[model samples]
Target: MAAPIFSLAFALLLRLTYATAQVDPALISRACEYAKGGPTCVAWLQDNEDDAELSGIDRSDPDSIAFFSLKKIEKEAVTVSEAVSAKLSAGTTEDLSPATQQGLAECKDHYVPAVDLIKEGVDSLAGKAYPDAMKFLRTSTLDLIACQKSLAKLRTDKKDTEADVHATDAINRRDLLASHVALAQSILEFAASGGGAAAASVAAPPS
Candidate 1:
Protein backbone atom coordinates (compact mmCIF):
# COMPACT_ATOMS: atom_id res chain seq x y z
CA MET A 1 0.00 0.00 0.00
CA ALA A 2 2.82 2.41 0.82
CA ALA A 3 4.55 1.75 -2.51
CA PRO A 4 1.31 2.27 -4.42
CA ILE A 5 0.56 5.57 -2.58
CA PHE A 6 4.10 6.82 -3.14
CA SER A 7 3.86 6.14 -6.88
CA LEU A 8 0.52 7.96 -7.15
CA ALA A 9 1.88 10.98 -5.26
CA PHE A 10 4.88 11.19 -7.57
CA ALA A 11 2.60 11.02 -10.63
CA LEU A 12 0.45 13.84 -9.26
CA LEU A 13 3.58 15.88 -8.60
CA LEU A 14 4.71 15.41 -12.18
CA ARG A 15 1.35 16.54 -13.48
CA LEU A 16 1.42 19.65 -11.29
CA THR A 17 4.94 20.47 -12.44
CA TYR A 18 3.91 20.27 -16.09
CA ALA A 19 0.77 22.27 -15.45
CA THR A 20 2.71 25.18 -13.98
CA ALA A 21 5.73 25.08 -16.28
CA GLN A 22 7.13 28.22 -17.86
CA VAL A 23 5.67 29.52 -21.11
CA ASP A 24 6.89 27.86 -24.27
CA PRO A 25 9.66 29.84 -25.93
CA ALA A 26 8.43 28.79 -29.38
CA LEU A 27 4.94 30.11 -28.68
CA ILE A 28 6.37 33.43 -27.55
CA SER A 29 8.52 33.60 -30.69
CA ARG A 30 5.62 32.80 -32.98
CA ALA A 31 3.30 35.29 -31.31
CA CYS A 32 5.92 38.06 -31.27
CA GLU A 33 6.65 37.52 -34.98
CA TYR A 34 3.61 39.58 -35.85
CA ALA A 35 4.42 42.36 -33.36
CA LYS A 36 5.81 45.67 -34.60
CA GLY A 37 8.64 45.36 -32.12
CA GLY A 38 9.28 41.71 -33.08
CA PRO A 39 12.38 40.62 -31.17
CA THR A 40 11.97 43.45 -28.72
CA CYS A 41 8.48 42.21 -27.92
CA VAL A 42 9.75 38.75 -27.17
CA ALA A 43 12.52 40.07 -24.98
CA TRP A 44 10.19 42.39 -23.11
CA LEU A 45 7.74 39.62 -22.23
CA GLN A 46 10.50 37.27 -21.19
CA ASP A 47 12.21 39.93 -19.11
CA ASN A 48 8.94 40.65 -17.30
CA GLU A 49 8.28 37.03 -16.41
CA ASP A 50 8.67 37.80 -12.75
CA ASP A 51 6.31 40.76 -12.70
CA ALA A 52 3.65 40.34 -10.02
CA GLU A 53 0.78 40.60 -12.48
CA LEU A 54 2.42 38.39 -15.10
CA SER A 55 3.79 35.71 -12.81
CA GLY A 56 0.37 34.27 -12.01
CA ILE A 57 -0.92 34.03 -15.57
CA ASP A 58 -1.27 31.09 -17.88
CA ARG A 59 2.02 31.65 -19.67
CA SER A 60 1.40 28.78 -22.08
CA ASP A 61 -1.52 30.60 -23.66
CA PRO A 62 -0.89 33.37 -26.15
CA ASP A 63 -4.10 35.11 -25.12
CA SER A 64 -2.97 35.31 -21.52
CA ILE A 65 0.40 36.61 -22.57
CA ALA A 66 -1.30 39.20 -24.73
CA PHE A 67 -3.48 40.28 -21.85
CA PHE A 68 -0.43 40.54 -19.67
CA SER A 69 1.17 42.79 -22.22
CA LEU A 70 -1.76 45.18 -22.11
CA LYS A 71 -1.53 45.37 -18.35
CA LYS A 72 2.13 46.25 -18.79
CA ILE A 73 1.23 49.04 -21.18
CA GLU A 74 -1.14 50.56 -18.65
CA LYS A 75 1.59 50.47 -16.01
CA GLU A 76 4.06 52.07 -18.38
CA ALA A 77 1.64 54.85 -19.23
CA VAL A 78 1.15 55.67 -15.56
CA THR A 79 4.91 55.65 -14.99
CA VAL A 80 5.55 57.98 -17.92
CA SER A 81 2.82 60.35 -16.80
CA GLU A 82 4.27 60.53 -13.32
CA ALA A 83 7.76 61.08 -14.63
CA VAL A 84 6.58 63.92 -16.85
CA SER A 85 4.78 65.52 -13.90
CA ALA A 86 7.95 65.30 -11.87
CA LYS A 87 9.96 66.93 -14.61
CA LEU A 88 7.48 69.78 -14.89
CA SER A 89 7.60 70.32 -11.16
CA ALA A 90 11.38 70.42 -11.20
CA GLY A 91 11.47 72.96 -14.08
CA THR A 92 11.19 75.80 -11.53
CA THR A 93 14.70 75.02 -10.29
CA GLU A 94 16.14 73.14 -13.28
CA ASP A 95 16.99 76.01 -15.67
CA LEU A 96 14.32 74.85 -18.12
CA SER A 97 13.17 77.38 -20.72
CA PRO A 98 9.55 78.43 -21.01
CA ALA A 99 9.10 76.51 -24.25
CA THR A 100 10.61 73.38 -22.75
CA GLN A 101 8.43 73.73 -19.69
CA GLN A 102 5.33 74.14 -21.84
CA GLY A 103 6.23 71.09 -23.88
CA LEU A 104 6.73 68.97 -20.79
CA ALA A 105 3.41 70.20 -19.42
CA GLU A 106 1.68 69.26 -22.67
CA CYS A 107 3.24 65.82 -22.56
CA LYS A 108 1.96 65.37 -19.03
CA ASP A 109 -1.53 66.34 -20.13
CA HIS A 110 -1.48 63.80 -22.92
CA TYR A 111 0.03 61.01 -20.88
CA VAL A 112 -2.38 61.50 -17.99
CA PRO A 113 -5.40 60.80 -20.17
CA ALA A 114 -3.57 58.02 -21.95
CA VAL A 115 -3.15 56.17 -18.69
CA ASP A 116 -6.93 56.14 -18.19
CA LEU A 117 -7.55 54.95 -21.74
CA ILE A 118 -5.05 52.17 -21.26
CA LYS A 119 -6.79 51.16 -18.06
CA GLU A 120 -10.06 50.98 -19.95
CA GLY A 121 -8.39 48.89 -22.61
CA VAL A 122 -7.11 46.47 -20.03
CA ASP A 123 -10.60 46.17 -18.54
CA SER A 124 -12.09 45.62 -21.98
CA LEU A 125 -9.56 42.96 -22.74
CA ALA A 126 -10.21 41.24 -19.45
CA GLY A 127 -13.89 41.07 -20.33
CA LYS A 128 -13.10 39.56 -23.74
CA ALA A 129 -14.54 42.57 -25.52
CA TYR A 130 -12.01 42.43 -28.29
CA PRO A 131 -13.39 45.24 -30.42
CA ASP A 132 -13.74 47.56 -27.48
CA ALA A 133 -10.32 46.61 -26.23
CA MET A 134 -8.74 47.34 -29.58
CA LYS A 135 -10.57 50.60 -29.84
CA PHE A 136 -9.35 51.81 -26.46
CA LEU A 137 -5.80 50.66 -27.13
CA ARG A 138 -5.74 52.46 -30.48
CA THR A 139 -7.26 55.58 -29.01
CA SER A 140 -4.62 55.65 -26.31
CA THR A 141 -1.99 56.08 -29.01
CA LEU A 142 -3.52 59.36 -30.07
CA ASP A 143 -2.27 60.91 -26.85
CA LEU A 144 1.16 59.46 -27.47
CA ILE A 145 1.16 61.08 -30.89
CA ALA A 146 0.06 64.34 -29.39
CA CYS A 147 2.84 64.11 -26.84
CA GLN A 148 5.30 63.44 -29.64
CA LYS A 149 4.09 66.50 -31.51
CA SER A 150 4.56 68.61 -28.42
CA LEU A 151 8.11 67.36 -28.14
CA ALA A 152 8.69 68.01 -31.82
CA LYS A 153 7.57 71.61 -31.41
CA LEU A 154 9.99 71.98 -28.55
CA ARG A 155 12.81 70.61 -30.69
CA THR A 156 11.90 72.94 -33.58
CA ASP A 157 11.89 75.95 -31.28
CA LYS A 158 14.60 74.80 -28.93
CA LYS A 159 16.42 77.72 -27.28
CA ASP A 160 19.41 75.71 -26.17
CA THR A 161 20.96 72.24 -26.21
CA GLU A 162 19.37 71.64 -22.83
CA ALA A 163 15.89 72.04 -24.30
CA ASP A 164 16.83 69.62 -27.06
CA VAL A 165 18.07 67.14 -24.50
CA HIS A 166 14.83 67.37 -22.54
CA ALA A 167 12.77 66.89 -25.70
CA THR A 168 14.87 63.90 -26.70
CA ASP A 169 14.44 62.24 -23.33
CA ALA A 170 10.67 62.70 -23.41
CA ILE A 171 10.50 61.42 -26.98
CA ASN A 172 12.41 58.28 -26.05
CA ARG A 173 9.95 57.53 -23.26
CA ARG A 174 7.00 58.19 -25.53
CA ASP A 175 8.44 55.90 -28.19
CA LEU A 176 8.81 53.09 -25.69
CA LEU A 177 5.15 53.52 -24.70
CA ALA A 178 4.15 53.38 -28.36
CA SER A 179 6.17 50.21 -28.93
CA HIS A 180 4.56 48.45 -26.01
CA VAL A 181 1.12 49.45 -27.23
CA ALA A 182 1.88 48.12 -30.69
CA LEU A 183 3.22 44.87 -29.30
CA ALA A 184 0.11 44.40 -27.16
CA GLN A 185 -2.13 45.06 -30.13
CA SER A 186 -0.27 42.54 -32.24
CA ILE A 187 -0.52 39.91 -29.53
CA LEU A 188 -4.27 40.51 -29.27
CA GLU A 189 -4.60 40.10 -33.03
CA PHE A 190 -2.76 36.83 -32.84
CA ALA A 191 -4.91 35.56 -29.98
CA ALA A 192 -8.14 36.52 -31.70
CA SER A 193 -7.08 34.70 -34.86
CA GLY A 194 -6.75 31.27 -33.27
CA GLY A 195 -3.37 31.57 -31.60
CA GLY A 196 -5.23 31.21 -28.28
CA ALA A 197 -8.65 32.08 -26.84
CA ALA A 198 -8.02 31.30 -23.21
CA ALA A 199 -8.19 34.96 -22.41
CA ALA A 200 -11.84 34.96 -23.38
CA SER A 201 -12.55 32.56 -20.55
CA VAL A 202 -10.11 33.78 -17.95
CA ALA A 203 -11.93 34.00 -14.59
CA ALA A 204 -10.15 37.05 -13.18
CA PRO A 205 -8.10 40.03 -14.22
CA PRO A 206 -4.43 40.28 -13.47
CA SER A 207 -3.87 41.55 -9.93
Candidate 2:
Protein backbone atom coordinates (compact mmCIF):
# COMPACT_ATOMS: atom_id res chain seq x y z
CA MET A 1 0.00 0.00 0.00
CA ALA A 2 2.88 2.42 0.80
CA ALA A 3 4.51 1.59 -2.53
CA PRO A 4 1.28 2.43 -4.37
CA ILE A 5 1.03 5.75 -2.53
CA PHE A 6 4.60 6.65 -3.42
CA SER A 7 3.94 5.78 -7.07
CA LEU A 8 0.91 8.04 -7.14
CA ALA A 9 2.86 10.93 -5.62
CA PHE A 10 5.60 10.53 -8.22
CA ALA A 11 3.10 10.58 -11.04
CA LEU A 12 1.52 13.75 -9.69
CA LEU A 13 4.93 15.39 -9.44
CA LEU A 14 5.70 14.52 -13.06
CA ARG A 15 2.42 15.99 -14.21
CA LEU A 16 3.03 19.18 -12.30
CA THR A 17 6.50 19.51 -13.80
CA TYR A 18 5.22 19.06 -17.32
CA ALA A 19 2.52 21.60 -16.80
CA THR A 20 5.01 24.13 -15.50
CA ALA A 21 7.31 23.64 -18.48
CA GLN A 22 4.62 24.01 -21.12
CA VAL A 23 4.92 27.53 -22.44
CA ASP A 24 3.42 28.31 -25.84
CA PRO A 25 5.94 29.43 -28.46
CA ALA A 26 3.36 31.34 -30.43
CA LEU A 27 2.93 33.86 -27.62
CA ILE A 28 6.58 34.81 -27.88
CA SER A 29 6.33 35.08 -31.65
CA ARG A 30 3.28 37.32 -31.42
CA ALA A 31 4.91 39.61 -28.88
CA CYS A 32 7.99 39.93 -31.07
CA GLU A 33 5.79 40.93 -33.97
CA TYR A 34 4.33 43.90 -32.09
CA ALA A 35 7.18 45.13 -29.87
CA LYS A 36 9.79 47.60 -31.14
CA GLY A 37 12.72 45.36 -30.35
CA GLY A 38 11.75 41.92 -31.56
CA PRO A 39 14.76 40.11 -30.21
CA THR A 40 14.52 41.92 -26.89
CA CYS A 41 10.84 41.17 -26.58
CA VAL A 42 11.34 37.51 -27.39
CA ALA A 43 14.17 37.15 -24.91
CA TRP A 44 12.32 39.05 -22.23
CA LEU A 45 9.19 36.93 -22.55
CA GLN A 46 11.15 33.70 -22.42
CA ASP A 47 13.05 34.78 -19.37
CA ASN A 48 10.20 36.40 -17.46
CA GLU A 49 7.28 34.15 -18.36
CA ASP A 50 7.33 32.70 -14.87
CA ASP A 51 7.26 35.98 -13.03
CA ALA A 52 4.77 36.49 -10.21
CA GLU A 53 2.83 39.06 -12.21
CA LEU A 54 2.29 36.53 -15.00
CA SER A 55 1.07 33.84 -12.65
CA GLY A 56 -2.34 32.30 -13.45
CA ILE A 57 -2.13 33.51 -17.04
CA ASP A 58 -2.31 30.96 -19.81
CA ARG A 59 0.99 31.08 -21.62
CA SER A 60 -0.62 29.56 -24.70
CA ASP A 61 -2.94 32.48 -25.38
CA PRO A 62 -1.53 35.27 -27.51
CA ASP A 63 -4.34 37.67 -26.69
CA SER A 64 -3.77 37.40 -22.96
CA ILE A 65 -0.06 37.95 -23.44
CA ALA A 66 -0.66 41.02 -25.57
CA PHE A 67 -2.97 42.62 -23.05
CA PHE A 68 -0.46 42.16 -20.27
CA SER A 69 2.30 43.49 -22.50
CA LEU A 70 0.35 46.70 -23.12
CA LYS A 71 -0.23 47.25 -19.43
CA LYS A 72 3.45 46.74 -18.72
CA ILE A 73 4.33 49.27 -21.39
CA GLU A 74 1.84 51.67 -19.88
CA LYS A 75 3.57 51.39 -16.52
CA GLU A 76 6.95 51.94 -18.15
CA ALA A 77 5.73 55.07 -19.91
CA VAL A 78 4.63 56.52 -16.62
CA THR A 79 8.11 55.96 -15.19
CA VAL A 80 9.71 57.61 -18.19
CA SER A 81 7.42 60.61 -17.82
CA GLU A 82 8.41 60.95 -14.19
CA ALA A 83 12.07 60.87 -15.10
CA VAL A 84 11.56 63.51 -17.78
CA SER A 85 9.69 65.67 -15.31
CA ALA A 86 12.52 65.40 -12.82
CA LYS A 87 15.03 66.46 -15.46
CA LEU A 88 12.91 69.43 -16.43
CA SER A 89 12.48 70.49 -12.85
CA ALA A 90 16.21 70.23 -12.28
CA GLY A 91 16.86 72.41 -15.34
CA THR A 92 14.78 75.19 -13.82
CA THR A 93 17.41 75.60 -11.11
CA GLU A 94 20.30 76.05 -13.54
CA ASP A 95 21.40 79.34 -15.08
CA LEU A 96 18.98 79.07 -17.96
CA SER A 97 17.96 82.08 -20.04
CA PRO A 98 14.46 83.53 -19.53
CA ALA A 99 13.28 82.16 -22.86
CA THR A 100 14.68 78.73 -22.05
CA GLN A 101 12.90 78.81 -18.70
CA GLN A 102 9.64 79.61 -20.44
CA GLY A 103 10.21 76.77 -22.87
CA LEU A 104 10.80 74.39 -19.98
CA ALA A 105 7.51 75.55 -18.50
CA GLU A 106 5.77 74.73 -21.77
CA CYS A 107 7.48 71.37 -21.84
CA LYS A 108 6.12 70.61 -18.39
CA ASP A 109 2.66 71.56 -19.56
CA HIS A 110 2.88 69.12 -22.46
CA TYR A 111 3.84 66.30 -20.14
CA VAL A 112 0.72 66.89 -18.06
CA PRO A 113 -1.43 65.07 -20.59
CA ALA A 114 1.37 62.75 -21.70
CA VAL A 115 1.76 60.93 -18.38
CA ASP A 116 -1.89 60.03 -17.72
CA LEU A 117 -2.87 59.36 -21.31
CA ILE A 118 -1.02 56.06 -21.41
CA LYS A 119 -2.73 54.96 -18.20
CA GLU A 120 -6.10 55.92 -19.65
CA GLY A 121 -5.22 54.08 -22.82
CA VAL A 122 -4.45 50.97 -20.82
CA ASP A 123 -7.74 51.22 -18.97
CA SER A 124 -9.61 51.72 -22.21
CA LEU A 125 -7.97 48.68 -23.67
CA ALA A 126 -8.88 46.67 -20.60
CA GLY A 127 -12.50 47.76 -21.09
CA LYS A 128 -12.32 46.78 -24.81
CA ALA A 129 -12.86 50.37 -25.82
CA TYR A 130 -10.51 50.19 -28.77
CA PRO A 131 -11.25 53.59 -30.32
CA ASP A 132 -10.74 55.43 -27.08
CA ALA A 133 -7.54 53.57 -26.34
CA MET A 134 -6.16 54.33 -29.78
CA LYS A 135 -7.05 57.98 -29.41
CA PHE A 136 -5.32 58.21 -26.05
CA LEU A 137 -2.25 56.38 -27.32
CA ARG A 138 -1.93 58.64 -30.34
CA THR A 139 -2.50 61.71 -28.22
CA SER A 140 0.19 60.57 -25.82
CA THR A 141 2.61 60.23 -28.67
CA LEU A 142 1.73 63.73 -29.84
CA ASP A 143 2.30 65.07 -26.36
CA LEU A 144 5.78 63.55 -26.27
CA ILE A 145 6.57 65.21 -29.57
CA ALA A 146 5.26 68.51 -28.35
CA CYS A 147 7.48 68.26 -25.29
CA GLN A 148 10.48 67.61 -27.49
CA LYS A 149 9.65 70.62 -29.63
CA SER A 150 9.42 72.79 -26.55
CA LEU A 151 12.88 71.66 -25.47
CA ALA A 152 14.21 72.26 -28.98
CA LYS A 153 13.05 75.83 -28.83
CA LEU A 154 15.15 76.45 -25.75
CA ARG A 155 18.50 78.10 -26.60
CA THR A 156 21.24 76.55 -24.50
CA ASP A 157 23.82 79.12 -25.80
CA LYS A 158 26.56 76.55 -25.29
CA LYS A 159 27.00 72.81 -25.39
CA ASP A 160 27.86 70.51 -22.47
CA THR A 161 26.19 72.75 -19.93
CA GLU A 162 23.95 71.31 -17.20
CA ALA A 163 20.83 72.60 -18.92
CA ASP A 164 21.93 71.14 -22.26
CA VAL A 165 22.59 67.77 -20.64
CA HIS A 166 19.23 67.79 -18.88
CA ALA A 167 17.43 68.83 -22.05
CA THR A 168 19.11 65.99 -23.88
CA ASP A 169 18.06 63.66 -21.12
CA ALA A 170 14.51 64.88 -21.50
CA ILE A 171 14.66 64.13 -25.22
CA ASN A 172 15.90 60.65 -24.52
CA ARG A 173 13.05 60.10 -22.11
CA ARG A 174 10.63 61.32 -24.75
CA ASP A 175 12.04 58.82 -27.22
CA LEU A 176 11.65 56.05 -24.68
CA LEU A 177 8.05 57.04 -24.06
CA ALA A 178 7.52 57.17 -27.81
CA SER A 179 8.62 53.55 -28.14
CA HIS A 180 6.26 52.53 -25.35
CA VAL A 181 3.48 54.45 -27.09
CA ALA A 182 4.20 52.62 -30.32
CA LEU A 183 4.20 49.26 -28.56
CA ALA A 184 0.95 50.15 -26.86
CA GLN A 185 -0.55 51.05 -30.22
CA SER A 186 0.41 47.72 -31.73
CA ILE A 187 -1.02 45.83 -28.79
CA LEU A 188 -4.22 47.84 -29.02
CA GLU A 189 -4.55 46.90 -32.66
CA PHE A 190 -4.13 43.25 -31.77
CA ALA A 191 -6.69 43.51 -28.97
CA ALA A 192 -9.13 45.26 -31.30
CA SER A 193 -8.94 42.27 -33.57
CA GLY A 194 -10.43 40.29 -30.67
CA GLY A 195 -7.21 39.73 -28.72
CA GLY A 196 -7.89 41.32 -25.34
CA ALA A 197 -9.42 39.34 -22.53
CA ALA A 198 -13.16 39.55 -21.75
CA ALA A 199 -12.00 39.90 -18.18
CA ALA A 200 -8.60 41.02 -16.83
CA SER A 201 -7.04 37.72 -15.90
CA VAL A 202 -3.55 38.30 -17.24
CA ALA A 203 -1.30 40.79 -15.51
CA ALA A 204 2.03 42.34 -16.61
CA PRO A 205 5.15 40.40 -17.55
CA PRO A 206 8.65 41.17 -16.21
CA SER A 207 10.46 44.46 -16.57
TM-score of 2: 0.64
The deviation in Å at residue 67 for candidate 1 is 0.7
Model 1 lDDT per residue over 70-128, tens place: 86788788777766666566566556768878887888888877888877766665555
TM-score of every candidate: 0.74, 0.64
lDDT of 2 at 26: 72
Off by over 4 Å in 2: 1-25, 34-37, 40-60, 154-161, 195-207
Tens-digit lDDT track of model 2 for 36-119: 458766664455435444343334555455545555655555555566566566666666777777776777787767767766
Clashing pairs in 1: none
Candidate 1 local lDDT, residue 31: 81
